[model samples]
Target chain A: MLSESDLGALAITLKLALLTTLILLLLGTPLAWWMARSRWRFKFLLEAVVALPLVLPPTVLGFYLLVALGPHGPVGGLMESLGGRSLAFTFTGLVIGSVFYSMPFVVQPLQNAFTAVGRRPLEVAATLRASPLDRFFTVAIPLARPGFFTAAVLGFAHTVGEFGVVLMIGGNIPGETQVVSIAIYDHVEGLEYVHAHWLSGGLLLMSFLMLIAVYALNRRFSVVQP
Target chain B: MTIEARFRIDRDDFSLDVDLSVPSRGITALFGPSGCGKTTLLRAIAGLEYHHDGFLKVGDRTWQDSDCFVPPYRRPLGYVFQEASLFAHLTVRRNLEYGIKRVPAAERKVSLQQAIELLGIGHLLERRPARLSGGERQRVAIARSLAVSPRLLLMDEPLAALDVNRKQEILPYIESLHNDLDIPVIYVSHSPDEVARLADHLVLLEAGRVTASGAISDMLTRLDLPLAHGSDAEALIEATVAGHDEAYHLTHLDFTGGRFTVVRKELPVGSAVRLRVAARDVSLTLEWQSGTSILNIFPAIVDEVIADGEARMTVRLMVGGVPMLARITRKSASVLGLKAGKLVYAQAKSVALLS
Candidate 1:
């Protein structure tokens, strides 16, 4: 069983993951759609930038983000001028890190799904008197449903398991930024093997079940649609 | 009224340039071989191909000009692609209603019920497009287009993607549209048979240019065109049911040329029909023979004789002002002394009823 402080860390992790997933969904949909449809040659540059966190070392990204959000950095300086404190050690700082860390997981599936929808249905809708915005809502969004599911599941799951980036940015502050992974790290470092086992086992079981559900639903969607 | 268009498209390997004035009623078929820009012309008319310098005016509405351009969603036109392209997520009924819901109430001319009955697709309303056969999907597509109540209809080789059986299944529905609706239709086709059966006006395209434009019958038989010189060359004759001899199962058809006795059909008197007489099936005789197996003969005057091949000659004849073609050998022509202004008997071996 997790101690009271361990339970607090778990709750903070869940809240952070949930907030990050929602923000990523809101920001990624249009960017993924544009990436799928644009013919410009420079589009690959943006795609590479988005996919950087996938191949990047978590500590390196964490280091860069810490600088960018610190008091002397450009973003933190702008926030300070706008009547806000430096975001380096806040819950909002952890969410911003988690969003960057899990972005590729949310956006790649959506881009592939939008590309699969093709241009024919949109052209047909236009001939049927549907405006551009109308076609996006009525045709494009409905057709890309499976992609949304995959993106949400992957985004949420990836954020829940974040470790190194959160450590570098929001370092082990109980009830504020200390998540389950960091809490388990503290348990094992302090020679509490039983507590570490409980937290790690629960994390493993939850991740596996979420993955199984996503795979099952993905197969069902393909069978029903194709 | 007419649909007038002028388009110039420049591409890397191909280009299209044409000016057209087609009738604003019935069907006008754009007939050409593949890669001859027939589909490009249709797309331009529908406002789908925007990367072109073009002018289009249908009836009194100017869809595109030098200073103005209307997007596809705002144009009052229905376009049917070669593929049916039905929405995979929607039921057939929902697909048909998609276009109907977009048109304003005052502009709604065609009812959903009328469209459904015209295409005979009521049984398919609840089914998704994935479950439909090719013919049924295309019928539903046509009905969906009609439900929009477009001012003009554009079809880009709608049957090109179907097999022969499927094409046969959908042709009657397409034929009925001209009679049931007053909308003008621009149809693109590579098959001559489809153009013959459906077109009121024929526009022949070749290498991105209009080679000939006129009535279907005139275009089919004009000596200057390649249509009359092919082995399947035939002349179209308009006839009406005159009388029926039920005792012998024979039907008499009246045309400007003469009376034709054919196998009896299930048609009422005075009903109009089209007849196709192949040039190879007609033989010229200097005099009518009473004792013969051939039952149909007409007295015609030879108008012109042109060499068809090395050994064959095609004789054009005027039978009461209706033109008919007879292909015979040059030796036979010379032996019979067939010439212009000479009176001859045209024995028709067989005539096919088109509709």
Candidate 2:
């Protein structure tokens, strides 16, 4: 009993999730690597800020993001001055909000993986004549492969399930910014039980399968130390 | 050629202050007990440990000074850590080639094939480090270090982590490295047996300080040092294989001082060998004793005699030019009137041939 509009929402949700995961990975890798290896006294403060979304209610994050990305806000004013439109209530706004909501999901595993790779291997690389940058790429990245896999799956899945953040920052708009979660909410609000049942059940199966794949793949990819 | 290192490192629990000038050839051992700063010194030389106000010069190149410091990767040196920390992800061949591929082709002193052949790791090239036994892994580690063709090699207790059997298996490879390569090596070891067999020059460290440094034979027999006072007190001598006595199943080795007929060895004639004669195994005699059970009897001139205890004393003697030590009861020393420049004969119970 799902309409064509509902299918459009599901496709947008998948698009947003995939794009956000990719962006988060690109921006978060160096940040997480620094947090894992730096000896600076104030590094913990940055760590706490990255971890805020994990404990903060998603609605609060969404509200703050909404205000900052609106027409009157700093970012929105800058966009207008540059002859562009405000990001609020746009697909881009939803991705930005989802990335924030899922920041910890991508960074925590990466930080743990980088830290677990201790300094000894890097020292060995130095003695073997590997430059610092070469060591990071050839040694650290390969050793932290499991963390990359976990972060990718978790960021994508968590972004797909986002409701509060998306609803606040990206107001529901058919075929534009309406994701599957918001579509299900709209169906329930309109008292259309049959349509809501199909969408909700589909999301349930999708989320469960995504989680199963993450766990199964992680267990298989983890390095077995002698 | 020479290597000069002057450094002072201040740690929370310990401090290392060393200034040394060593020849840039052969194996020079940094010998001391654990926690004696031997490894700290080696790390500083390799540019791995940055001590403030450090100065290092290898040949004419200044590796580290007040205004400039060369990082480990840029410095042409190979360091073997106490553990054979081979790259776990790479196969043995890849690990060996890791350093070889980094240096410019013109600067590559040792080829991949040469390193593999030197360490005898040709058969294990395809194996992963995890699958290797301890001895095999250490050999691969050594081969990997040599692949870079470093100007200087620093080995920090390379055999400390191996079992006795494994140590025996790896010692020959290390000896061959000393004999075959022209690269200068700085080896750190606390085991006297290792120093006795491998080190040509000795740098004795105590409490983060260099106590003594010189040729191995002189360092081992210096009575002023604690090395000569232990239960294992012995003297090292350089000897050449003269010939084999097939009838008696003995090998006659000639040194500057005298000739020693040792139990038959497999070494070919004319090969240089080292021998260690323990003080306890040498007995002093004022005259040549005929019909004695001992086979090693050499004419010696008493060099020095020191009272060790109320009833015991130690006598140092020079048999030809090689130094020999004897621990005699004070009664025997007084009866023989042993003194410097006194002529005597030394009867050795046994001699250990070390090559």
Looking at model 2 chain A, report the run of 10 residues with the lowest lDDT sum.
A217-226
TM-score of each: 0.94, 0.95
Candidate 1 C-alpha error for residue A193, in Å: 3.3
Best by DockQ: 1
Per residue, candidate 2 scores C-alpha lDDT tens digits across B222-323 of 888878767788889889999999998999999998889988998899999889999888998888999898888999999888777688777788889888
Provide interface RMSD per model, one decimal: 1.3, 1.4
lDDT of 1 at B227: 84
lDDT per residue for candidate 1 within B59-151, as digits (tens), equals 899999998889999999998989999988889999999999999999999999999999999999999888899999999999999999999
Can you tell me the CAPRI class of model 2? medium
Interface RMSD measured for model 2: 1.4
DockQ for every prediction shown = 0.67, 0.62
